[model samples]
Target: MPATPVADPFDALDPVARRATPRVRIAVGAAVVLFIAAVAIAALVSSAATGGGAQGTIVAGGGAPATDLGVAAASDGGASGSPRVATPPLLVHVLGAVTRPGLVELAAGARVVDAVAAAGGFTAEADPAGVNLARPVVDGEQLMVLAVGQAPPPATGGAGASSGATADGTVHLNTADVAALDTLPRIGPALAQRIIDWREANGPFTSIDQLLEVAGIGDTVFSGLADKVAP
Candidate 1:
């Protein structure tokens, strides 16, 4: 046709444009990879800066650890687990011939000696022979210590000679001790002591019939003791 369009040698030799396109695509891909790497590195650094996943951590008053504080609390609770029990006290009435007389509180199972001590012991005129200090005391019982050289209390009735004598005719209500008084008909140690207590509280009996005035004594008791008792 017009000499085959006169073949262009320059066009056939030029591969510069095609090579340049491949280089540009490669550069863009490398840039994208660098940006992703930078973002990943920054995330990792932030995670390391702060406490990430640790658990069960405590901060005490002085920044003590959780384990230390927990152990201390457990120790305290264990030490106070059981409480102590207290014992009950005894109330006693101590009167007559003591430095300080009235009610006194003492430990349980206390003896008369303990009661006397609680009442400030005995006074100068206290006659220890009148009481059994070694004996144990009961809650509501009264204790009385007689004065030294004190005579038996007077009887309620007018004075009379000894009446209800024992087999030896020597027993007397005012002068008899607990043992001698216990020998009286229907009279026991307790009643004898009661009689002594009554005599000490009131005066000695003036007549055998005055025994009726003492506690635990009635007409029958008086009749039994009528011939044996005296003022």
Candidate 2:
């Protein structure tokens, strides 16, 4: 009617409503942008964890590569690949005259003699008497050898030689070197050497009676050694 009520463009839009519309649009755009960014970040993280690549790249802590534990030493001093030696089951028993007696296990084909040596060999007085040094040892076999110069130890197990009920025992004069002769009660190194020198100079004694010819041996001394001496 009045020139169609010439409307003002500014008046056509309400100032308060216009301002509110822009704010709403800005907030909705921001929310959509945040959602898209979040989706992109999540996709990237998932791909990294599962080892994604053109083909399939290995990633540490992901489904990646593995190492062989049985590797031999490499040029860098790390293992690459190899095998280990397998040990055999071996057992042996050592007894008699050894410093320690017991059962021991060793590598297969180990010798009995080796087992005895492992147990500490023979004691100072061990009787090499009946022992066959060259005999091959078997598992669980018992070795018994006597000590030097002593009577066979009684089966009863005392380490000392047993004294005879009468007159003790006789000493072997022929085998009695100075060291052996020293076992006599009062004899010492000097006397022992003297006796050994005498025996060496003369032939083997024919009888126990010939001992008197040695220096320092007289009737009374001979009587004392009568039961103790042997030819």
Candidate 3:
């Protein structure tokens, strides 16, 4: 019989082939691991860029971090959140016999004495006795300080001291005491006190019409007094 085909048992043990097969498998496994890692890294970077993470990140002006952007926004909000405070002053007109007579600004609840003091006090010729310094000053009211020995102007236009009497006779506004003032028509004790108070606060009245400026007196009361009272 023909010699049987020679069996080469060492073919399976070829050194180069054995070593190269294991090396190829190891290289393919390492390449797959590296590809997976690259994909994961790319996903992380995309999420951060789009601000999709729980602690969102922002690329601000000049590529500033998210924290810096938040801080800047907070600062701006704080600056505009506070409110401003304001307080208005009272304006008054001070006239006659003061060293510096004109408009003066005073705090609320200021008195006539405070206004006079603001106008450099009274001049030596000023008659302080006629002015009630303790009176509370009203806005837009003119304060006229009288000069000593000055005579008040005569009443005219039927508004001056009465030349005729009404049964009990007319009472003088400048000279009348509280009891005397109460005798005129519609003149009660309270109204009388107000008149006296007004006369004391302001200097002697130059005309009966000036009575209208008193706190309590109005057109109705003035008309009633017009026929009977004088400056």
The best candidate in terms of TM-score: 3
Spell out the clash pairs found in candidate 2. 71-80, 71-81, 72-81, 126-147, 127-146, 127-147
- Return the TM-score for each candidate structure: 0.34, 0.28, 0.35
Stretches > 4 Å off in candidate 1: 1-85, 151-231
Off by over 4 Å in 3: 1-87, 153-193, 196-231
Instruction: Give residue 44's error in model 2 in angstroms.
Output: 99
User: Candidate 1 at 22: error in angstroms?
Assistant: 66
lDDT of 2 by residue, 59-101 (tens): 3545323332223234324423355457656555555668988
Judge candidate 3 against the unseen true structure and give its global Cα lDDT, from 0 to 1: 0.69
Give the lDDT of residue 211 in candidate 3: 82
Better of 2 and 3 by lDDT: 3
**Evaluated with lDDT, which candidate comes out highest?**
3
Give per-model CA RMSD.
Answer: 17.8, 18.5, 13.4
Candidate rank order under lDDT: 3, 1, 2
User: What is residue 138's positional error in candidate 2, in angstroms?
Assistant: 35
Choose 2 or 3, whichever is better by TM-score. Answer: 3
Model 2 Cα shift for residue 167 (angstroms): 13
lDDT of 3 by residue, 1-231 (tens): 899988766468788876688788999999999999999999999998978766735564454466666676576664434754445666766766899998899887898899999998999998787566777766655566667865432223242223222334566677654434655667654676688788888978789898898777899988998877776
